[model samples]
Target: MASTETVKVKVEFGGGTELLLAPPQDKRHSLTLPRKDAAGTETNVTFLIEYIRKNLITEREELFVDGDSVRPGILVLINNSDWELEGEGDYVLQDGDEVVFISTLHGG
Candidate 1:
């Protein structure tokens, strides 16, 4: 069996995305996730997204997740850099990395 190491990261929500959490008020969280996935591969933002959807999101999952990544209109930032510059969902998380999710779509 492969040993699982944990990575700790800070996640923040904004642009109304904070309202999607269970409490709907807590927008920041320090999360611990396995460094390796079940397949014994290094985990990435994709894994983290699933983790948040499963463990943090309480309802209206569609608002947060669309398939394997976040739904359209949600911007992702890693360590203050646009996730697109960091390879988006493919970026391997580092300890203490700051991940921010901001939703750009909102009801008018």
Candidate 2:
């Protein structure tokens, strides 16, 4: 089994909302965010990429976008560059890297 490690993710919203979301206590490989628009909705984001391998070997890996049950609109960015525009699940994350998730807000 791979030794679990914790990664700090700073989640920010376009509407000036920010939070320091961490992985679950038991599994240091997943992140979950609550759905703001959907009442009582939750989303689970996981880190399946080989973080340690990438750090030791290559500096980049194809990024993947994944979440739990919720279907909220999310925009992932690294160093202010949009990951989707670059190619969904094709970006690389590094040590001490900053990953930001921006939630989409919908109104009547």
* Alpha carbon lDDT of each predicted model: 0.90, 0.35
Of the candidates shown, which would achieve the greatest TM-score relative to the real structure? 1
Question: Which candidate gets the maximum lDDT versus the true structure?
Answer: 1
Worst 10 residues of 2 by lDDT: 19-28
lDDT of 2 by residue, 1-43 (tens): 2212333434333421122122121212232222221343221
lDDT over C-alpha atoms for residue 23 of model 1: 81
Instruction: List TM-scores for all candidates, in order.
Output: 0.92, 0.36
lDDT of 1 by residue, 1-104 (tens): 32348888899999988887888468899988899999987889999999999988888989999999999999999999999999999999988899999999
TM-score of 2: 0.36
